[model samples]
Target: MKKTVFACDACGYETHKWMGKCPRCSGWDTIKEYKIEKEETQVHEKPLIVNDEDFIEEKIVLGMAEMDRVLGGGLVSGSSILLGGDPGIGKTTLCFEIASKMVELGHNVLYISGEESLKQLSLRKKRLNLQKPFSMLTTNRLEDILHAIRETPYNLVVIDSIQSTYNTSLPMLPGSIGQIKDVSSNLIMEMKRADMAHIFIGHVTKEGVIAGPKILEHMVDTVLYFEGDKMLPYRLLRAIKNRFGPVDEVGIFQMSKQGLISVENPSQFFVSERSNIGSGSTLFPYITGSRPIILEVQAITPKTNFSIPKRISLGYDSNRLFIIIAILEKVLGKPFFDRDVYVNVTGGMKVNETAIDLAVAASILSSYKDINIGKNTCLFGEIGLTGEVRKVVNMELRLKECGRLGINRIFCPQGVEGVDSGVAGMEIIPLKNVKELNSLAFSK
Candidate 1:
């Protein structure tokens, strides 16, 4: 018997009946009916496993410290990584840098381009000034690519983009959900069997999610996202999932005409243009993985004409902003019900840690009261629903970064013990509740 089910293509929500909109994802006209064909097949024995003596758990250095930092020291053999980013966001450029660096290390590398032709790749190579010799193939045929993989003696292989490749046996066109699922699954299996490292570039949807089924992210050993405005000079590589390294690892790069270069001092790059003394602006030390960088949090509040005040956040959570606003209104007797509030994290970096909660609250309060909290001051702490400020993890690292950046005054939550007051040439101020921060506001 054939099994049929209607599913939402966007989120994979299934139902026995079709509907105009998906109840789970709210996608309009995105539901499609697909049939599940059942067939019997013989089960095979497990493949040969490598012995401890034969297998090496070594990592291959990519020559770039920043790239290596993000990959948890370096790329591992037989590892599969999926990289996603918007168009012209320096995804291809960074991959070329990897290929060039790998080749420079006296390792053979194979580059398969399904998107760009030979001429286009050659032009890019010349523009990038890549001198190291490496193998290259421009084809979308999965079998041919697999055959090349089997024949080539390569330590590293890079597929320019998985969306551009398709298996001719599949009836669907390239980049379709079916083709991406089938092609990536096959390539991953082959790479694992061959014990060669492979990196696949994936395209992201308008919603900033990787294209194809959600399972695509689960099959890879690592999932990295290249983020930055195309108009900006900086690009950020963030690892959302890493089986070999720590997740949430980030690498900063400055895009120049010579290509992408690593930013040695990310803290300086983030707050270089910050105003010294401004209301609705506060310096914040945010920890991304093991590295701590200083970011500026800015907020603005204006009286709204609508019945429901609008809360807008850029590079921050809107819901969290609203929660902070509500906390201030309840604790400090400040009313934001009739105001339009906006919050932004400078440097185009998105921070989701609760350690920046106190900084966010301070910025919002400063904006509402039009008060500057003075210069050379930084803040970090988590705010509780009961108006209490809670201590965050890695307090020493956060304070050390602030001290390195010449920040003198630091406000943190109370009850944190074993902390030296002069650890970083900065004075640590402990606060018990949100009410204590009210002194930061300017008096009318």
Candidate 2:
């Protein structure tokens, strides 16, 4: 006899009790139970073999500079890629763009989707002015898809989404942990054997991760994600993992009437709609995941009756906000209990790192004390519990961008030098603590 328990389709963790909160990873309602079938028959494992003649290192190259740079030069043949994002964030448009480029390269590509019909895809492509020779399949059955792949022999294959694809023999329903894994694993293995590249558009959950089990990410060779708010029309393509190329490379695109146009100077995208007189608004050079961009930070403190202050923030981690508030109260001798401290990063994008700590603190202080920070200047430094403005990483890269955008001054931690290569011929004002920077930065 064999025993089995439910596992989280997103992150593979086994559990007995069905509860909303996961004990292992603290994810809510992601746990799914499925029966594991066992067979008495024995099977043999295959041995590995390696040879230079058997491997061909040719990757498909699309001329789109932004897309190509993020994929580590180009899409590798016979590699499976996973793109995870929320609904209506241009995931489908990107796939069509890739298919169009592939067809231009004289490669036959097949786009099998379960979400839309041929007519709907045609309409969207026409809106995008896309004219490419490619085939589309509308089916959920894994067997039928396998047959199509076998007979069609397309050079490239794209699965609009893996969550919608299901396995027939499995007793679990589609989108279940078991079925999604089976489908992804089977497709990846088949692609390897057939020497075809497979692309899967995965759905992101409320927790901001892929919907399928954590294992789904493991099944694919590369994982890419769309970053930024859809309302802003600017989206960033970031590579979290890549077996063929380097990770942390980002590609910027602006969704518009002509589809996604590459934003060459991404710094301009962050600096939109400047206000002259705001009680508590300032700029911050936020760098996270190798992305260097300057963003506006605004803070407002309103009188409140509640004993516990209402601490609210947008596009920033709540826990990080809490910690900083506590630090402000204890270390800096500030009172926040009598007011509601609200913060917003302007653009609806998540930025979590210690790098923006100084900027955030400055914005809040500016509001609390009724001061003004220079509009043409941005600050990037980490704030410690002892009121020290700690130095951040990639100072050179940060200053270079700041200087390029007509930003006159940058206030960072003290003791930072060019080291080797850095932004020169600019005022890189260095300070040790909040009090030191405040004495001069706000005095003007």
Candidate 3:
């Protein structure tokens, strides 16, 4: 029997009748009707428990160290990965590079593009100097794409975009919620059955989230977000959800005339343009994935003529900034009411970890009082509402990275485990609370 049901586009909340607003998500007019035809079910196959040693999973190494690292060493066969990013942010370029690299390793790879023409793909290939040839299909029809994949014996398949592809049976236009859900479900089932590895490139909304129902992220084995400023050359590929690897792992790459090149030393690259005597700049070690990266947190507090001092931030959370500012005012007796505070994480990187709390507070104080904290000094700790400095995870890793970068002085929470046997030539200063920052960093 065929039946029609209305589903919310935002959260996939479905109901039998249509409503002006989604009851689940409270999104107005986000409900759309879609027909479903129930089909006959087949007999279920018997399940058997198998030993771990009996089943060996195979992985395809793409030969790119950064890409492999983000994929938890390599791509597992029969797994589907969803990658979302802004337009022209190198999502396609990065996929093309991955396809080219796989072809060089003599793997049967197929590149399906619903958005670009065959000529356009060729031009990009020439520009990237990709000499190795791979299978290419330029079509938006879901039937044709599925037929091509099933007919060929491909080890890997790349879908340029899921939004552009549509099924003819669906009356809705391409990129609709129904179409995305149906297309991705079918493609994933097919890939799993054939034991093929696939990568789906998805479009992101204006708010920088994947431009489909949140269900799409849950459907894939791994979800990666390609983030970077369009004006800048650096791009960060971060794993948001991964069943096979650790989440929040980031792979750094530098865009060049040829293609995306992996950054070997991201810590050095991020702080390469830093000035030594800058009052507003403070060095902080951040851990993204398994690697520790040294980042420069810059803050400037200039007196504002307006009644409300602007609290502006770039690459750092604005709400968190407000909280930090309130804590500094209540705890440190710093008068930021008359100044416009600006905080930025250099290198176009976004930091969400609470470990950056102390560094941000220090940078703000440094700029306000016009004190130089020195480029060789680094700090990382979480600041509580009561002015206490909380300890952070991976303290040893963060400290080692600072030591390797030639940073001699460190400010961290008191009683860090590795402080007793500290890094050679590094002075580890333990801070008990935000109140100590004034005398330690500023020496008033």
Candidate 4:
């Protein structure tokens, strides 16, 4: 017997003999090694020598500022983006918004929705009060949709969901890995041949992950996530992967009966109704997705119901909340060990920026110490275990934004050197420890 060995497909472990178990990647029943048969080369194809001006390339502008920014200023011809989000989070609304804008700019858009019928799509637009007209196609067959795109001179195509659309050529159902791979690959090839911009909508799992094979995301030019609180009508279009724009870029939209409207300056939208000089609540600017937004953080220390008092953090991490509590207890003389600590960042935006660390610490202690961090003052910085507040990125820019938005006082991390006073004439209160902030919050 003449045979050669190979590695497992799921696991990278090499196998002299194929086994049931994979040693490296630990994937079950995935170890299948095979030998390659030798073949002779027949064709010698010359590579196409490239020049910048060789081909006349025309791109489509999607007509949404945030959407265009995510796609590197405009949609590259024949590029595809995967749009994934939870159900009822205004993903379709944003898609319709994009289509409407494109139609207004004289671009033909094909919105193929396997999830909704033409009448249903129209009903959504009616509810949104939008009168803009565009082509709407309802089909589940991938081959039929490809034929329609080929027959027409459409500038863009949007598949409402890749999981719901099936290819008749494939044996499996629509959402199967095989079908997704085959359909996506075929769609990409067709889009390239036709020179069309495509956006593939993907349904996500309950755990906030995109359904289907992970390779589907890698196969696309960009991946857009519509992430926000489902309870609230507001939604955020987040770019987790961008071939052109910064990955952390975001677009805030509020979903109403009328449709998704951009929330300009979401900083004000988040922290507007904050009560001044309140216990258990403090307002500070939290950098969310590279945008500095002021938010109210409330922390409550109540009697524990369990032996290990629960630390509940809404819109942030529980471990981070506890670490802030520990730092506050040790360095700021605020005690919350035996009590159940509950922390919340209002507006339902998760902020992991190192800049918000100082503000979070201050808010927790402000609630515990019965002090206020002042009404018109916003704070942000990183905190070390040694109680030394560390400086954050774009201090001057944050301060400028705050000042432009009428923030009176700014608390920055100490050693913000070269930020001369009155450069913006904003009061820059630098603090080294929680104690300094504690003194200022309680000081007359």
Taken over the whole model, the C-alpha lDDT of each candidate is 0.87, 0.80, 0.89, 0.77
Candidate that beats the other on lDDT, 1 or 3, i.e. the better one = 3
Local lDDT at 138 for model 3: 95
What residue runs in model 4 are displaced by over 4 Å at the alpha carbon? Answer: 1-46, 55-61, 275-277, 288-290, 420-425
Candidate 1's TM-score reads: 0.88
Clashing pairs in 3: none
Best TM-score among the predictions, by candidate number: 3
Candidate ordering by lDDT (highest first): 3, 1, 2, 4
Per-residue lDDT of candidate 2, residues 1-444 (tens digit):
455677765545667767777676688887776676677697776998989898778878888777888889898888889998889888998888999899999998999988899899888889989887689888888887898998877778989889899887565567877788889888888878898888899999999999978988887889999877867888888888899887767788889886888777667877867747566887787765455778888888888768877989997777777777777777667888897889898776567668888788788888887888767878888888777888778887788778778887778887666432244556677888887766767665
- Predict model 4's lDDT versus the native: 0.77
> Tens digit of lDDT per residue, candidate 1, span 74-186?
99988999999998898889999999998898888999998898888888988988998788899988998999998876788999899889888554558877778889999
Better of 2 and 4 by lDDT: 2
Can you write out model 4's per-residue Cα lDDT over 9-98, one digit (the tens) per residue? 542356688777767667777665556444465656688889999877555676666667556677776778899998878778888888
Predict model 2's lDDT versus the native: 0.80
Model 4, residue 367: what's the lDDT?
63
| Candidate 1, residue 100: how far the Cα is off, in Å | 0.3
Colliding pairs, model 2: 9-213, 10-213, 10-214
Assess every candidate by TM-score: 0.88, 0.84, 0.90, 0.85
Q: What ranges in model 3 sit over 4 Å off?
A: 1-51, 417-423
